[model samples]
Target: MQLSFLNLASNNLSGKVPDCWARWPYIVGVNLGNNHFTRILQTSMSSLPLLEMLNLRNNSFSGNLPSFLKNGSSLVSLDLGENQFSGMIPSWVGQSLSNLKILVLRSNKFSGPIPHQICNMSVLQILDLAHNELTGYVPKCVNHLSAMLVINNSLESYIYFPVSGGQLLVEPLLLKERVYDYSSNLGLITSIDFSNNELSGEIPTELTGLKRLHFLNLSNNHFIGQIPQNIGNMESLETMDFSRNHLTGTQIQSFEASSFVGNYDLYGPPLNNSCSSNSSSNKEEVHHVKGINWFFVSMAFGFIVGFWAVVGPLLYSSSWRYAYFQFIDRMWYKLQYRCYW
Candidate 1:
């Protein structure tokens, strides 16, 4: 008996992917994604020459690249994202899979320099190698990928296949910060994602020549130097992210703590959102302002004392009031006598 397709994805299937897969010589597509499946030993595996699409993403599969995949010349789409797979990616992947259009190794533990041989895949439309520990330079020959340089209006940007269960299967990839399956006439959607890696060195200037490339993400990496001035040549570019990179070197190092050290009013992280300096100084100023407000008090006290000293006797004593009236009368009589004379 021969099987044409096998898709048991997103089913919570556990344990190892059975070695029985090696027996399916006639199989065309295999999708066992989003499951809890464990390691598949190299000894039990064999090459399936007819295999076109193999998706084993989001699994517990570990160890190096599967040896059987070295002969996957018929493979068009291969996704192995969010797995525990470790070690260096083999160079033969570029030498073998010339027919590959999409290759996704996102969120894996892959380390070491990306094999520059991948620049040979002339027909590759999407290449995702993000969230890994990969280092070294992105090959200057990246623009040699001929598919990214051209635009085809009649082609669909995503990969979709008819499963054995008589249903359509769409391969998922990261596009515009989202993780979803896109199935439509996406209009020459070519992407290059090397984000979340330790990759260093300047971005290749030849990357600007890819006129039809749709999405480009090199975020969270150690990429340095200026962005290519000819980037505007990418006429069909819709989404491009260079955030969290070392493009201009350190993102926050130049801002320095000294620039904000005395910013007592500023509040936030690296500053802990607590203005202790402002709070302490503000409390001391409250007391200082309070103690310095004695001028009004002294004015009122002097006014009360002066008013009583001059007019208290007139109000409180009759004898003193009569003497004050007599003195005024004598001054008035003396003034009239002098005027009459």
Candidate 2:
């Protein structure tokens, strides 16, 4: 019994769980999801020295999460989503679950900011906490989980960054890295996805530091401000999505129209150049051209007027004087002939 694998998923099991299930020393996997067990998880279950995977989703367990799991050294994957758990996430989670690989706690009532200590888990691969009441800026250390897969249980619209030689996936950071496969474990790390949360503020420019990053998604959040110009410099990036936010500025030519949509403030190619800065640039160019035309016209008019004024007197005195004498002589001869006296 202590060395067996227990899988009781989708069962109608009700009432308090037996304590005997917790004392098992060699349990490798346990699935109690979609059950009606109303009692809090036994503390002794956390004491199980060899438990690797546990699924207790879709339950009515309330109050703060148990602290014993934080001390469970051998736990690899844990799924406690769809519960009524509340309070700030414990900071010791990353520090305590050093060997943990996959953790899911989505669709819960948990609130408050994510702990920065989450970056401490160097071996973590997948983390999902979507559809929760959590708020505040995404923890920056999340970028440190080099082998991490998905974040927040959103695999459909999220970007999957994988280690070198890893296969790309359509799920949110849902791609798999083959650390166990000697041929595929090339130690390359790429990908991050954080969409549809209450996260606000500017996108960190430092994220461009991930040179190996090929895909990124930060949509449906409250992020505002100009898209960092450096984002275009990521040569390895093949797909990027930053739609449905308050981002503003001219769209970078490096990214296509699909990269940014639903942002009312964003404008340029594929749409009208309605952005204020882009319009202002066009207006300045028009004004510059008008000023140059006015300058050249004024210079030409001044040259013509100045040249005539300087040479007019000489022309009238030399050329016009001879003509005037001839006209006078002709008029005197005509007068003599007509008078005849």
Candidate 3:
């Protein structure tokens, strides 16, 4: 048969996938999620050399990392989340699937430290291991995932592959009780979720280097120590959760300037609030005081000019002074004659 894509998700289908995968050499995408599919046969992947997307989530598939995936060098997005899979997250995923952009194994029973080898995927953008039994510190080599470092607003986030007649798209995923549209913003999103685990140790400072990461969740763990001091370097963060942990870090994760309210010692690019906001207010206050002083000065000058305009003539002009006194005397004489009559 000539097949390029097979999507049997959310069908309530049960039973193991047939061992006939080797029969389709042109297959590029296979999704068997949200079903009762039990297991991935060990040798079933030798045939689909062109497979790029494999989503086996929300199923009863249980076992160590599938051996067949080690040879899936062309795979780009692998989501085995919400499965019964257990065992150490294998290293071959990084050794072989070097082109992967999305890797999610959340809601599984997998245990053990995240393999440093997984950092080999330079283009990886989304990594979710939440709601698992995994333990161990996050590998410091995470900065090696180069795609999470810089924000590529152009053609990088549109990660899709053109198959024989159509396209294989990645759906959205949920992390920390929230889900994002899987495909539209896939390439533009850089996230990491390791919440609800047994992991401990200081968070690697290297994580601060991912200057464009959008979401981060490390809640419900045994972590201690302050957050990385250089975290100010990550400027593109949006949603961050570090609750329910042993973290003594100021737990400061805000983009608002008010987050630095009492820090008279803080200084840097974005922290220049005192210079921008306060200086503007101070200038306005000084301008208002200057206006009030000028008004009072002008009023006093007007009062002096008016008083002098009337009194100066009476004081300096002899004829005008004599006329003023003669008018007063005539008014007094008329009042006396009226009284006598």
Candidate 4:
């Protein structure tokens, strides 16, 4: 029977998504995750031109990404994590599906550079490309993610049925290190997970511009260099993991050892390694402080000597001291007489 929503998740269902889905022209949501399905996804998926959400996580779907998704302009959430899908993530992902807000491809065999063209998806908020063999530096254009740069508390990413005018079924979101179904508050979640890959290079400083980002995971990679100096600028960050990489820096606040474990070059609080530079710098500062103290002492001594030199002869000579006091007293009496008269 034709349906607008189909959910067969966590079942014994196997093999490819049925060819019958093509007949469901009104289909808006499809979930077949956690199954034993194998082999290639049918190109018939192109038949459902209005398909909005597709979940194939924890399946055995293999081979290169099917270009059939190019026709799925209405797609907003696509999850293919924990699969065997290989090959580069298509550039068309950002070119065609501009409305997509959530994209997950974790634990896949996909490799090659993450296309900078994907930065074109201004509305994409949650992106998980971890647990892959992907190599190359992260795209510096990450600041282009406009949706993640702002706090969204609405349900703008929800799927809606065209005919009924009612909201469609909710989709699963992997957030805060777990999977949860987000129904009415999907827009509030913003995160990026690119850990456990061969991705190398410095973490882009531009990523700190994602002020509304709530979670970030860049652990278990080949990243080098210090963590971005302004990483604390991500004020909305609630959870982050940068462990098992080659990162070098002092311990970041609000993070624990697990977040930086396996990173030998990093030091400071939360890590057993102390920053020896801190001690040496303190010693140098002590010498500078001592020099400043002696300079102040010399200024005070010179002022005292100069003051006594000018007044010592007047005090020793009784006649000069009497004359000086008499002059001061005469001036004071004259000023008082002028005021009273």
Candidate 5:
């Protein structure tokens, strides 16, 4: 009998994945999640080239990522979250799993900076690495995620693998702040979750370019600096979380106060703290007032000096004053005659 699907989830199955299952060449999806599966996966992996979806979440899988992941280049969705898996996320992930549209490694012991090579996943639409021990800056090259940047109208966008019974499912993803089941409308949903880690640095402004992205979570981390001012450009963003960080800025009108809580340094509307009215404005006002006072005093002094100079001269020389009046009267009459003509 040819087998194409297996669901051994929530069974408390112990020990490594069975070696016998490798002989099933037609198998496309495997679910061993919610089990006590432990120890290293054996060489049976090389036998399953057609495997597309693998879920080993909520397990005791330990040590480095399996090389079979590299072997399974045909994979479209992979979930290893909620595992005891340690060590850095392999660079080979980007190199081998280039076809991956959804990748989740949250709630693991994985550490170190995210590899820049991850930008190579041009079709990757959902990435969740929250609740890990990861450190270092969020890779700025993440702007290279083309799938999130452009709208995918293709009918083949949803993740599904053919099975004897039906297509095997990709489970609903639980992010740090939200749970998204992109099963029906996968192509229309794009999100990135890097919250609850040791990740530090300014949230990259480049992320605003993902105009089709619907959700983003960078909360519960050490990220510093103001939220990107152009974040409003992410028109598709329906959910976002930047809480429990050092983020400081004016509150964006698009998001509610809950989206930015735990950021003690941040001040704006939606939060109780108003933007501080600083002394700079007062100082400027004082300086302007002083300048205007000085200008008026200078103008008044000039008027008095000019009046005294001309009037004193006129008083001392009646002939000059009389000549000046005669000249003014002749010019006024000549101007009126020209206007009448």
Candidate 6:
């Protein structure tokens, strides 16, 4: 049977995916998504030498992804999203999927830094791996994929490019030309939505080099420090959201207020207040105020001492000295003599 298309979507298919499908050499596309299939994808699928498209999304598959397609040169589109797959994406995916145009592995449980070797795929058009546990800085090689579209963790929406004949002819020259056009516009990159993960540290300033960046989302993560001021240099940026982070300092004036909603420490615009009041002026003012306080205190202390000395003898007889005692005694004797005469 020359099967061109076979879709077994939303089936209750249980257990591992059977390897018998590889016997059909003429099968161009196969989809076994949305099933209860358990265990990792078998390595035997790579034997299908003529397979062009494959989809095994929304399954219970677990463990490190098998690099079965390391030598499959004919695959153009591959989707393994929404599975239980874990560990780093195999490095060979980039090395072997040179002819691949669309690749998707979003909504999986995969963790680890994005592989730098992904730049080797010069023919990749659309790449999506959003909503995973992936961390670390975005690979610089991501700029090479010019024809990428719908790079999101949520796979609800997609970009569709209609083929003229309702089916692609699969010409090698046309494929080469498409790859060449993609590589030529290497700077026309796709959106990278790494938000809602555990990614930390400052925003990589190197990402500003992507001249054709249209969408950027780094929200709801552990990223700290100020947003890179050089982000304004990305002239083609149409949408950017860095909310729910620890971004501080002033962002470029061009960014809208909504772009920085959840960053509590961030302030807008530069302050005009002079922080340069002369040091000498401040010193003199402080000295003058101190001197006035000291003078009033000294005068008050002196007045208290003088008043106490003058009034003490009158208040207490024992406080009277010899001179004051003799004068009082002579006055008393004269008064007695005048009364007797």
Clash pairs, model 3 backbone: 157-187, 171-182, 172-182
Score residue 308 of candidate 5 by CA lDDT. Answer: 94
Tens-digit per-residue lDDT, 117-193, candidate 1: 89899889889999999999898988888889877665344445545543335465686468755445322468899
Give TM-scores for every candidate, taking all chains together and pairing residue i with residue i: 0.69, 0.60, 0.72, 0.75, 0.77, 0.60
Give the runs in model 3 whose Cα sits over 4 Å from its true position.
164-168, 253-341
C-alpha lDDT of all candidate models, in order? 0.76, 0.66, 0.80, 0.82, 0.82, 0.66
Model 2 over residues 1-341: C-alpha lDDT tens digits?
Answer: 44556767788898766777556776666778888887765467877777666778887767787776876787766778777778778888888887766576765777787788877776564466655666787666565765542223234322222211223211123322211222222123244555556667777775554444655667677788888777765656655678788888866766677667878778888655677865586689889999999999999999999998866765768766677678889999999989996
Give the number of the best model, judged by TM-score. Answer: 5
lDDT (Cα) of model 5: 0.82
Candidate 6 lDDT (Cα, 0 to 1): 0.66
- TM-score, candidate 3, is 0.72
TM-score (C-alpha) between model 6 and the true structure: 0.60
Off by over 4 Å in 1: 43-45, 154-168, 249-341
Writing each residue's lDDT as its tens digit, candidate 5 over 228-264 gives: 8898888788888888998776767668888888887
After superposition, the stretches of candidate 2 with alpha carbons farther than 4 Å from their true spots are: 148-193, 210-217, 228-241, 250-260, 269-341
The Cα error of candidate 4 at residue 205, in Å, is 0.2
Using TM-score as the yardstick, the better of models 1 and 3 is: 3
Candidate 6 residue lDDT tens string, 1-341: 76666778788998977777656767767778888889655556777777777778888888887677675787876778778888988787888887776677766887888787776776564456666787786676665654442233232222221222234322111110122233323223455566666677788776676555566777777778878767777766766778788877766566666666666566654322122333344467789999999999999999999998877775766547666778889999999999999
Candidate 2: count the clashes: 7
Question: For candidate 1, what is the TM-score?
Answer: 0.69
As a whole number from 0 to 100, the lDDT of residue 327 in candidate 2 is 86
What are the runs in model 4 whose C-alpha is more than 4 Å off?
A: 154-184, 277-341
* lDDT over C-alpha atoms for residue 189 of model 1: 65
